[model samples]
Target: MPVRRFVPIAAVVLVASLAACNPSATKSESDSKPAASASAGTDRDEAGSSAAPGAPAGGNGLSLSEAIAKIPAADEVRDGYKRDSFKHWIDEDGDSCSTRNEVLLAEAGRAPEQGARCALTGGEWRSYYDEVTVTAAGKLDIDHMVPLAEAWDSGASKWDADRRMRYANDLGAERSLVAVTAKTNRSKADKDPSEWMPPAQSAKCTYLADWTATKLRWKLSADERERAALETLAEGCSGTAVKYEAAP
Candidate 1:
């Protein structure tokens, strides 16, 4: 009986020893490695996300005045500027919605119903340029915040066709393209702040901010008169801030 009992005791000790040495023998030990790795991965992900708010790291928190000061002052050249130099209103995603339609769709006060081929109907829009309210889409024009010609005069004349195309159809910034009445847009055609401003008195400050933001975004230069005009206009827009993302 003593011999049998001793053999059983030794077998139990051996089994326990094997379990301690074998990774697969204990379920908790096997799961602990993956669990620790997952926890480390989670910590890394949180760290990466914490740094995202300041990312894109282009231009985030600049006062309107400070932003305007960054644009280099130069003489504007209208030479060789043509409307066709920049191709626009493209269906960039083949969604059948042209850049023009896309702007209209986004700025509509009442969302329009989209149909086959991106046909839009039954929407209301408030044209901030003139403060006009309209229900018809045809009456609206998608105005480039910085007109193509103005862009050309500033510095885009030197850019390649592809870059010019991107400028013309810039949807990356909400302020880059605006929906406004056709009349107001035509009235402001190819004119900088020095020559034109929104007819609505309330919209002037916002307009200046938009113009400044767009110029800064594209690294566009401002002429002497244009800069002066911007300064004068900015005076009325106290406590205003400009935010923009640099164009790629």
Candidate 2:
């Protein structure tokens, strides 16, 4: 496969023309389905200020402090786990675009030509995981912020199939699913924050915030070692914040 390339002038011009053709063609994170209702046994902090099951507290989501506090720590269980357990890439809204295509459309810096059946021809995107700029959609992977295996180990092993599906196909938050270079996504395969981090140093803060927020949103637990790693990383990310709606 070809390495990252500069955004071609023709692609830029094409995107601009598309924007002119349809003023509302641009997509945002909120365009996805409504927030899932909070579950009955939702966890909350001691202070009772975090019980509300809704979108992230702040417009940006949550501060590192808030996100860390929300995570429930527990021993992980990996029994009978399989990647196939979480069914993903569904066309949730009946649009031709699946979850993967929706992410590509939402994250693309320059819009691609949408052929029949939501086939994306050309676009530009920056893989924040490694700071690589890619033009071909084929070269990018829609990464689950918290990998499926990691989620199962953390707390998802106990969740029902429906909840797991919601977690996998989540598009309610911008930080949940990301478009990154295929290389970086594979390299990060199912590792927690303790085991791996983004290659781009500048992305570390945002990466941690997203990871933490995703865990809290889904009510997933972190093992002692993983929590320790996140706390240590949080120390360096001083004013950074995470924004995500709690996954129902």
Candidate 3:
């Protein structure tokens, strides 16, 4: 395997040839090249879309104003935080696929072969975070929009195991658990919007919306800095909207 390189963040046009809409598309070695940055000034509309009021609006839902209003602001607590506290990747549906595999299957642009024990092979995926297309299943990582550790600091530290598990394995919304290239996922490890944004500039609006919706759904608090960053990002995403149900 070759090491992947990170590109500087800049807006770039998306090649329609690699669009996620093509289920039969296969990734070539050239497809492994870094993606162009997302378009920053694009104006997408969600008018009359069936998505809930808090759900992602055209993948860029809810104006920054509306999304920020939903997040409860508070100081974070990090004392006694541990990664193992939350149980994840369970086969909640008893389909033999773990939560990780389930996300991969859901997000793949080109479907892969599923073998015994739900092993996946030969799928094509479009990683929205950095706009990278990958052919192998092993190259992707399912990322928690609001990372578990960040959640702990925000409020999950007080949650019971069951609640934490529900959050960890959430598959209810498309924005909850995202499948992205391992490089982008690792680059985002445990950071909030304040510390990181997707390398793809076009992804910023959707990323902010997803981050906000996840926090609102899980009732997670945002620290002052994180909230400020989200607010700033939202301002740039003019027509976007967000609709998320409160977490049970």
Candidate 4:
């Protein structure tokens, strides 16, 4: 068998590895490549999109003001924040389903059934990781920006499953939301922003921005190495980008 390698990491590969083992991760060569690739890409992306939020006018991406402005302040909540507290993806219409699948359908641009369950009926995904385009639902995976188990390690080990569900199904934010090829998602599984990112070189700034934003929201603190990695990511927020959010 040919040894699979990743230029960057992404959703599919990470997801599988997250579930296949655990976040402490004994990830395979197939598993590690894309997540690392994507994670690195988000750190890089000098050649970016004009409309991508991270970059500035004729430049790379956003400034610290944008990154700070967009992030919900850690002190805003009086209540404790834990991973298990957010109840997510319950069958909204009383069908046998969950919200996580609904996001998969929407992210994939698929029109789901009345229940909005994950049937993966129709959608087209051009995976930035390996540059593969897929139409089948099975080919795509809905990824959580913060992996559940990783959350457990971070602070979520204490919350109830319902709360965990909410974190799992949170689709309200662009940073926390995305759809990617199944292989990439599986490979990502449950890892920190420090551990993985997207595979598209063009998407680097946005990836880091999302990472920073997600970390801020969860009130999760990064170790020194993680913080240093994020500082490097901050460099991407240069061209064509502006302040990211309205006061939160």
TM-score of each: 0.76, 0.76, 0.77, 0.56
Please tell me which predicted candidate would have the highest lDDT against the true structure: 3
Error of 4 at 120 (Å): 3.6
- The TM-score leader among the candidates is 3
Kindly report which residue pairs in candidate 2 clash with one another: 60-243, 61-243, 62-242
Residue-pair clashes per prediction, in order, are 0, 3, 13, 69
Q: Tell me the tens digit of each residue's lDDT in model 1 across 12-123.
A: 0001212332112322221121111111001111222212122123222455577679887889998999989999999887778888887777666677898998889888
Q: List model 2 lDDT by residue over 1-248, tens digit each.
A: 11111111010000121233111223222111111211111221112223234655443345576678779989988898998899999987776888899778766778889999999999888777777889999999999989999999988899899988988977654556788899999999999989999887756766776788778778899989999999998887655544444555
Model 1 scores a TM of: 0.76
In lDDT terms, how accurate is model 1? 0.65
Candidate 1 vs 4: which has more lDDT: 1
Q: Which stretches of candidate 1 lie over 4 Å from their true place?
A: 1-60
lDDT, residue 129, model 2: 71
Off by over 4 Å in 2: 1-62
lDDT of every predicted structure (CA atoms): 0.65, 0.66, 0.67, 0.45
Q: Write the per-residue lDDT of candidate 4 for residues 1-248, one digit (tens) a residue.
A: 11111111121112221243112333334323222233211211122221223322332223443543444322112245544455555665454445555444434433434433345466555454445666665666666665665555555555566556645655434335455677777777765556776676655554565555555555554555556556666565442122221101
**Model 4 misplaced regions, further than 4 Å:** 1-89, 93-97, 109-118, 128-131, 158-160, 240-248
Candidate 3 error regions (>4 Å): 1-49, 53-61
